[model samples]
Target: MRSTSRTEAFPAHTPAAAQIFTTVLSHGPLTRSEIAGRTRLSAAAVTKAVRPLIEAGYLVEDADDDARQPSLGRPANPVQVDGGRALFIGVKVTGDELIAVLTDLCCRIRVARHLPLTSRDPGAVLASITALVQELLTEADGFGVAVHGLGIAVSGDVDRAAGVVRYSPFLEWSDVPLAELASLATGLPVTVDNDVRALTVAEQWFGAGVGLSDFAVVTVGAGIGCGLVVHGHVVSGAHGVAGEIGHVAIDPAGPPCHCGNRGCVEAIAADSAIVGRIREVTGIEVADTAEAVDLAHAGNPGAREVYARAGDAIGRGIATVANLLGPERVIISGEGLAAYDLFAEQIREAFAAAAFGSAARCDLQTRPLPFEEWARGAAATAIQSFIRSDTY
Candidate 1:
């Protein structure tokens, strides 16, 4: 694999420069005045910050016939990130598969690959990740741009700052120094983050949460997860475990959770929980979420009830998040959205019933993000790290 032994420093040295560059990346081609307005920076500051980025070929100006001429006392040329200037690699690790993507500086995915996992062991998963990165790196060679960094997203208690997987329930891992391992294997700087938080970064930069300073992302699937962007920053709690809506215990007398709790949101709504519940309630062998969804769609009342319960659990989880942080919007995504028809009403009703006074007004919308997007979210983190000089 082609690797850069030397770190490629981003030209934006100051926070203001990074902020301005990110503004253009997310909402460009935009005029300098627009960047200034969005970033709340002065026009002069935007110009000063943008110059270095443009000189480094990370930002480019476009000609507009209608643009005001600088000689006329105004600069009206719009600027945008040069997507082809740099490349990045992202990998999202799940219990059964790994999803990887190659993205440019703008976080636009150029290639995507999925590989099933034969084993959940750290070494095996790391090998798979390395192979995938090598494939994407070869693809990057075609574009002739160095792959600046790699970001790996995993579910559960990931300590991003320490680059450790404190615990991942699905993979049965704990305190695995994943970033260092991957960096050594691929010879590329790596950023490790929680899967949902990684996806939240993508949303903040290019998806639903764009232009919003406060929002939340709630994902329901193999595990229930939440990501919060409060005051324009992704909230990683003091213990690196914020927005963990999944483990919130809602019922003391209900289903037992793997976390040694009863009726936790994840225990009730996660895919495995729903599937197990369906089997126990209906006395049928449902192999996976797809099969369970089919049974529910085929008018199996028991199966439908299982999904309804799952939905209620999810809705209550969302309401709890809203009542606490009071985000302006809550985006519901993940693989579990496939069965939305089975549980949509329950989710809405439960949320409405549980949400407190003004919290009920928070907008809740469903966006079905494919697995590939989660991988791209991983890529977004790499882009963020590259720009902010946080690479491993």
Candidate 2:
């Protein structure tokens, strides 16, 4: 538990201050001028905002080392976030397990804990999450910093503003008020967001999407999910459902989806979909994605074809995203990348065939993000909420 007597608040309250601080947090050790440039704020505004943060110990200016001085004798003192100033907790809930991480103000993971879930009942999951939070909170006590906030990442349709898990197919959940329940149980301000969007936040701050204003994160595994960042903002559409690439129906005659749609991307490309397809095609008793991948690697033509078809479906989904958003880059990640060798060519080929002329130019890069990184993304959202003063 956090010490009740230790009262602390972020110094800068204005939006400009939050923006400046976030710039420094993400791209710092940046000079004041660089912060101003990146944030497009006036130098005076940047200085004004940075002053309070620096004074409050959230931002730190580097020492005036002569070696860092420019040739013109101007001191280029870089400013950066003091990560140790505060702490946060992040929890990522999957159908089978709970992943939690203790992170600092700068969103660096300090400790990670994994707990297998015996049941997917909302109450059971919430209890597990509460217990995990308490454990991490006790761990934070050793760091001597206040755990300011907590963020929970859930899959499917999550209403972040309302702090609700609208639906999670894997967990068979609907309209679960997770954030409110977790906050009440754990005594910490909570931010609830879709798992992929939370990961996008981390990407914007520290991963492949850094320095790119327009990009998409396409994750392939249990479900085909996408997170879109347009004009430097992660889009959460008016209806609390945005970038749902998994439901894009590419083949009407294909498999039926749990969302009651036929031939949706997830129905064809997700892990279970691939596993089932391999079983049907090869008559092999593959238990999971690993066995399916192994069959393809062992020169099973039918299994390899199944992966190829899944890749084609995923590529078409990526093309749809590119056609609509024209993102500068599309980052492919998730556990499914373990079988990337089997599907890489098919994905590229299908994407090229499906993408429009200019959209085809979009860079497609593969990045392997582990479950721990997804948990870190949840922490990033907590840090985001804390700095922006949207505590809950």
Which ten-residue region of model 2 has the weakest summed lDDT?
A: 66-75
Across residues 121-217, which tens digit of lDDT does each residue of candidate 2 receive? 9999988998898898889889998888889999999999889999999999999988898888888888999999999999999999999999999
Q: Which stretches of candidate 1 lie over 4 Å from their true place?
A: 68-74
TM values, all candidates: 0.97, 0.96
lDDT per residue as tens, model 1, 1-392? 45654366999888889898888888999888889889999888988998888898999988754654553355788888999999999999999999999998989999999999999999999999999999998888899889999999999999999899999999999999999999999998899999999999999999999999999999999999999999999999998999999999988888999999899999999999999999999999999999999999999999999999999999999999999999999999999999998999999999999999999999999999998999999999988888888777
Give the poorly placed runs of model 2, Cα more than 4 Å off.
Answer: 1-6, 67-76
Worst lDDT run of 10 residues, candidate 1, spans 65-74
lDDT for 193 (candidate 1): 98
Look at candidate 1 and give me any clashing residue pairs.
none
